[model samples]
Target chain A: MRYWLTSAFIFLLVTAFSQEPPSTGFLRHLMDREYYKEVVYLLEQTDYDDASLARKDSINYIKGWSLYSMKALQRSAGVLKSVSRESPYYLPAHFFAAYNHAHLGQYGTAGQTLDSLRLENSNMASLRAFENAGIALLQRDYKAFEDRFNQADTSYYPIKKASDKMLDFARDLESHRKKSPVVAGAMSAIVPGAGKIYAGQTGEGISAFLTAGGLGFVTWENYHKNGWKDVKTLLFGAVFAAFYGGNIYGTVVSVEITENEFQKAYDNKILFNLHIPLRNVFN
Target chain B: MFLTKVSGQPEALHRADSLFKEGAFFEASIAYERTVYLQPESKVVHRARYKKAVAYRHLHRYEDALRELDRLPLFSIADTLKSRILYETAFNHLLLDKPEEALWNFRRLEKTREEPLHSSMIPLKILILNHNRKWEEAKGTLLSLVDSMPLRPHKKQSWKDSIKSLYDEDSLPKNYSEEKAKNLSRFIPGAGHIYTGYPWEGAASFLLNGAAIGFGIHQLWYKYYFTAYITGFGIFYKSYFGGMKRAAHLAEIARHNEMKKFNDKCSAMMMRILK
Candidate 1:
């Protein structure tokens, strides 16, 4: 009797405050407030097994978008790719899913995602071409980039600037002079910091020059002043020799670092350009 | 009437709270958010939001808790609710290692009428103030709070004395300026190290630099200009710059040690009161 009464009282308390929330607008409202975590959580908890195809698409789109915003790219891609072609969310889903794949370095899959989409929308076709060009650029394949870029209709407003930027990358990469380690090392041996300068590190080259020059002078002075037998002369000579050798080694290492840094910076730009149009067109 | 017409204990607020109690904080956070949407009343919404932030805190997601807490309308909230929000915000900020934000929230909360809550937070506030190196402010706060306590006059005075002693100038950390140490070492190699309490190292540095300079002068006097310029000046150049950097580094370590010792003492003194 006591347990039942207590249960009844609890039921009454629950019913006293009970009100049905409008399901359709509630998720949208949570999304508007940027409560992405909540949006995902709510969707996960609610039973949507019997939801209509269109309804399912909308739910999946929302889930993917929330995951994307939270930077869960792999999960976002998986969820987004599930949105059916019949749904209004198809274009954005496919585009972002491709972007996520590309981001995760699944270049082949990303290209295939774009390639398989046979959109009649002229703008989407251009977007597809632009995205393909970006992928080629990331792979550093200039020829593929040029062919795909020419197919892209640059007149599409959302992708026009990005298209131009992609072309610039093509031009820049074609003329880019990657420094060779052997040439840099040879130059450093001849002129202490010349190799670093050729590696595009002017400041470092000048600093190296001074250090090496100073050490060379020290070695010369020690030999001239103390007949090359005094402890001071020997010590200075040894120190000077080490600095000279280290400078040449450092020049080679610096050239490699500069080249790698340049490649990374350009790749980041290519990725960023690819992302802009997706946001502009989808949003 | 509308709420009562349907079956809702906050549309699962009780369930959310139960989840929180069961240590299912992540799930509780989601459930709290569900309640926020399902429940129409602004008060219920606020309650749910606060509970969600608390759940996030339990999950050690202080940044998320702070984000959720920021959605609450501070000016429009009830005073008690406002006090709790401020208290929770301070706690989250402290947990996130943001002493400044935590201190600001604690000070704002002090303006409320919740005397017991404010009193309870005194030690923590002092701890934060001490962490930030605002020693005088912490000292004043502790002394004032002691004065306001209804303890016997003698006991109160003793407490005040104890608090004052904790903030004594003699007990404070030695403040070493890295810039000053660097500057001193630039003019005289190892002077900064001496100032930072490494006398033997400082002497060694001084000898090395002095010998280099002397060798350069001796070579110059002998009319071996190239030898003096290269061997003597080259050694001096490296030693001089290297000594300056080492001096600044030593000063940083010295200052860190002193501050740690001072903060440790402060923490120990406040431990009993805080507990």
Candidate 2:
């Protein structure tokens, strides 16, 4: 079918050239200009019947290119997978296949495809960028992760900035956790209020320690004076015990939350830096 | 003679109508009552009696209105017209806070009327129960009604929000009974684990404490004081902590359960109304 179309075009070209006498270079340019779309349309319309080897190669190449352009990933990957080593597009096919696999969330498959392409094309640095983006997505980095994915590789500054943001959040959270428990415990130990102040719980810590201390002092004084006749001393002791324990528990849990946040941030940074499988597309 | 009675009836009705128009309902009712009595065998007499009931109702003389309404036999009225009258009677009773009477009329009206009376019926029952402060029963009835008639608009209007409000945690005590917790823990230990959110621990403590108590009792009965003391202390410690935790936990659980039940009932009611 393609041969028939080419013959017809050639026949039309000959007649048009005979009548108008346009330059061969301009006509050649027109045919070549439609080269990509025409070939893809022919391959799509064909049912893979017995065709010439050149025609087959042309169809497959155009099919892969068309799919890549349209972002029809799986189809593009399938077409690329069949490209032979002898073909001029064998390297590009491997790269495109890896990208398609990454987009479809098949990270492992994408990594294998990229590794093969890496072996064939030693100078292709862009493959490393794709690998890093894939890694970032897996690690759940919201920031630096999508830096390599902003339509092109214009700058790595966005990735660096994002990484810095993540680092700061992590460091701040870590420092907060480190100080929280120690401050909470020290405040309570010193005078109950001190530990709460350290824990950033000014009002709560002050009230807790003061209330318990006041009750404790009152209970001791009552026990000293009235013997065991009144229940005030025993009641106050119980209240003091509960308040002290609760304050300590609250501080510990608060610090743990801060630490967890930091750990999550750090993990995200590593993932974003290594696009493990590779997935950015330039249209 | 019939014509004479009818002619005289129109004059009495005219007089009653004039008094009714003037808002002199007592006199109007009296005149209508007499007119009906004079023409007792006529349909016009029954119609006049109904009008008198309406006048009495307008004057807030519900008892008098009910009495006049009672004189018109149910069979003497057309179903459509009678349903309207019955609905009015129910509404009047409802306005007077006589829900029991209102409910009766509503039920009767419901049988004849097609527009959401069964749904309307339950709220009156709930209102009556509410008036009596039989809240739990009222809530239960509403829940049952909501569940049974999952999507009746009248039923939704009748009970959903009201039932949910009735089952609110404010209805229960903050410091609920320990016995309830014990029973719950006995079936599923840690069942009452409150403030700490550790029900498994509560259950373990309860079970271990119960076992210790059983061992202590056996040891003490057999004169093994040393063993008894160890087991007894263990039992006491576990039981005390478990009981406290369980009570606090179960209080929260019960509060949540009641709230959930209330919400479920409300949703069911709203679904009925909207559907």
Candidate 1 local lDDT, A24-51, one digit each (tens)? 4455556667878877877676666665
Please report how far candidate 1 places residue A237 from its true position, in Å.
3.6
Q: Which candidate should be chosen as best, given DockQ against the real structure?
A: 1
- Chain B of candidate 1 vs. true chain B, TM: 0.71
Q: Residue A268 of model 1: what lDDT?
A: 83
Off by over 4 Å in 1: A1-30, A33-57, A84-87, A118-123, A227-234, B1-41, B44-75, B88-107, B114-118, B129-170, B175-275
Worst 10 residues of 2 chain A by lDDT: A274-283
Q: Estimate each model's TM-score.
A: 0.76, 0.28
Q: What C-alpha RMSD does candidate 2 show over the true interface residues after superposing them?
A: 44.2
Give lDDT per model, in order: 0.81, 0.58
Give me the overall lDDT of model 1: 0.81
Give the alpha carbon lDDT tens digit for every residue of B25-95 in model 1: 98788667767767756578888899999999999999999998999998989888888888889889987
DockQ, structure candidate 1:
0.31
Q: Which portions of model 2 miss their true places by more than 4 Å?
A: A1-154, A157-177, A180-183, A201-207, A210-214, A217-229, A265-283, B1-275
Identify the CAPRI category of the predicted complex in candidate 1.
acceptable
Query: Where does model 2 sit among the CAPRI classes?
Result: incorrect
Cα shift from native, residue B219, model 2 (Å): 45
